[model samples]
Target: MSTQTASSIEIEAFEPHPGWARQGRQPRIAIIGAGMSGIAAVVKLRRAGYTDLTVFEKADRVGGTWRENHYPGLSCDVPSYWYSFTFAKNPDWSHRFAYGPEIQAYMERTARDFGVLDVTHFDTPVTELRYEAPTWRLTTGRGDEHVFDVVISATGVLHHPAFPDIPGLDSFEGEAFHSARWNDDLDLAGKRVGIIGTGSTAAQIVGEIGPEVGRMSVFQRTPQWMAPLPQKAYSKAWKRFLRLFPFVQTLLYHFYYWYMTSRVGGAVLGDEKAHARLAEACRRNLAENVHDPELRARLTPDYKAACKRIVVASDFYPAICADNAELVTDAIERIEPGGVRTKDGRLHELDVLVLATGFDPTRFILPTKVTGENGVDLEKRWDDAPRAHRSMSVPGFPNLWMIEGPTGPVGNLSLITISEYQLGYVIQCLDKMKRDGLEAIAAREEAFDAYNAYLREGLKKTIWVTGGCHSWYIDKTGMPNLYPYAPQQFRKEMQRPDFSEYRLIHEV
Candidate 1:
């Protein structure tokens, strides 16, 4: 095992110069959200010879969703082996499916290792970003204004919590909070817990609180297909081997990536038989876990596995079969002063309410407003849906790149793989601009439109579109805006910069 000390770099102060024409001042780059994507961008930029970069994080720390969602049984749904950055591998993962703190610590370690934390402006939320033809102008919540040559909006779509607009939800007098913003102070011991929504977060919360609470009632709009996670502690021998031989670790990562990606094509786009097999796996898992016939029946999903994101839990089903827990599939009517009332006129009294209703994923690049050429509002352009060329650049937005951007696919694969590819593409663009003395490079409208159309068509055959389940992957218009159908196709498109698809202006 390689013994290395933690980073000793001191966090730097933000020093802003005048606009684009200022001499002796470096061309500044503003990165919104100090999450995995943003931090990866900074590291890649620095490696590519760009030094003047600033990362803005609204929260006090850098772990993004990991730092925010501190609810009970909060852990990564994806396997830890596949969830991390390809560049930085951790040989010391405690569990196959790591908990929240372990994941957050890994992110912190990555930032510190790359010395990106020093240049980050924590607790500074960007209010507005306007393109001033030659440069970009940014205003933060602190009323500070800064100008930059480029901006990268890595503030991921999943951070913002979305509560259902049910009547009397606001009138609930009891302690209520979203799953993302879990109130840790409210003790669940001997309390009647009413959990809404049956997504990943809901499953985790139910498993955790069922053992502790006096009575746990879970309101399920739709059931979720769950797979058993063979989550176990890493043996000392495995850790030693990984630390000693890094190449072996890399090979393992490649193997895992391909294996995971291969499943997507079959699970998402293959025949109904394949989907049925996955559903059977879920059924078998639930039956084996929960001995109670009634509880197993309630936990069984009617839809296919890939229709919604298949959750992985070792104890979630077993927890539901516990004496204190009960599953309610009826629709919620309203929240009375004391408890939640269902459509069947049943009022289930509860001491605390947990809303695991997921996020407002359609609101991409939110909170941080972006203005393109001629005061073009990015939000307005994406009013119908978020679109981008190769999920990186949009038309009229010059020198602006987004990591984990819209129409990018999400699955068991590592986000670091996509982030690395994007960073490479962005850096190559910047390098070309520097070499040719270019002023700006923006995606052409036709290219951007064609890309979106291609992505939409590709998604039609996938389970997300036809699997009879609604998720954050689809927007308000029932369009898939989050990811592509195939990760390989997306990677191939980002392999080389297509200068023809972009309008480049040279510096005179």
Candidate 2:
């Protein structure tokens, strides 16, 4: 038998149950990862009247990143009102930036209330997905095989933790772990703590635990552009008023979305004035906060702001300025049994070592063998670089969609809002399939290539490409693997699916 291209494939349509009529028919949908995106899919699909769906999660619970990272002072940099679901807004957020636990609890409550928990397969990870014309065969970790008409991969980017490769890293005698995999059992109070990587997670930890820890050493490889958080709690009256008049909460959500997207979006998109203003704010924050000239200079970032997703924390500078906290700018030589040894021949002793190194952004829904038509492997296709058509669908992958996938807009803005937009587009495509009696649909290769080309050209105008700093956003191809346009443009693009861009397979 000869293999067929996506455009050339045609297959038998889903047959309706003999007992049930055509109106009662529904496609079996399998959504991977019970994180925010997965939960959003469940709620949105169920409400849209598609009930035959199941979520497979590796972890025992919902809330992907939030559930994983429980480090102290782990709150969202985005405003709480904007970070939450647009459909289900929480009026009672304790602070402007919701804590990790609060976001996790919100996810659980959303899942529970929306009946997602019932349909979700907890602790079950999708090991592989194979497209066998018309349908997708899903293999779970338990060796269970399930076939579905459609599969949506909601496995997020930050789930896999990236560890720093240093000689004798394992030789450290003290408890060591990634920031995402925080050890709740260990008591950090009065303990000599050393944090590697001065990313957002490390800054948050330093801000929260610096005062209490006996001695804190923050090993900074590169300085991050620090932005003022200006986080504050909601008053009792404000909460009560929002609960009474929910429209006010909705108004606040839109306001925040506009504020963040326009400001941050413009800055990254090479708006010189906007970028300069933002960079100035960060510089002013560092200079005004850090009294010592040397410390201020050490804290200042040489690259353009928004290059590495500017670390937002009002308390970080103050925490670093504290008497107990010491910022070590020296390069790390190796890790001894007791602590981290720098190239300056200074050994910093620590009782606990925290690796605040972030995740490998490229490993989204990867390591899972996804074979499309003609046994085209997704991993191999993306071996050099990962690219998805408009950040949702891939070429040759029929009846499959990815939420918050490659080339999606991810930065200081709220991802929940972006995921919702992407989901809206996915649902529309699914609707077309159900309505038009289609067996399979994949992005046209020409269309995929064109869209990706457009993204690369647009990225040329963005700071991610122009900025001198190295960031996870830039893939090996020297192209930033994210939406480089403004959020409004992204929203406008996702507003409607261009049917011509897809290779739709009609049922035989």
CA displacement after TM-score superposition, residue 469 of candidate 2 (Å): 1.3
**Model 2: residues with Cα > 4 Å off, grouped in runs:** 1-24
lDDT of 2 at 439: 76
For all candidates in order, the CA lDDT equals 0.78, 0.85
TM-score of each: 0.92, 0.94
The 10-residue segment with the lowest total lDDT in model 2:
1-10
Return the lDDT, model 1, position 184.
78
| Error at 442, model 1, angstroms | 0.9
Query: Backbone clashes in each candidate structure, one number apiece?
Result: 4, 0
In candidate 2, residue 139 scores what lDDT?
A: 85
lDDT per residue as tens, model 1, 1-508: 1111212223244444333322434557888888888888888888788888888788777888888888999988666777778767898888877899888889989888887677777777899988776677888887878777888888875887898888888787788889988887887889998999888888888877788899998888878888877778889999999899978777777776776676544577655665777677778887788887776777777666878888877777877778888888888899888889999999999888889999877666766788888788998988887778878898888878888787777553467777788888998888777776667788998988777777777778888877777776677776576564666676787788988888877642
Tell me each candidate's RMSD, in Å, in order. 3.8, 6.3
Model 1: pairs clashing at backbone N, Cα or C within 3 Å: 407-483, 408-483, 409-483, 409-484
lDDT of 1 at 370: 85
Best by TM-score: 2
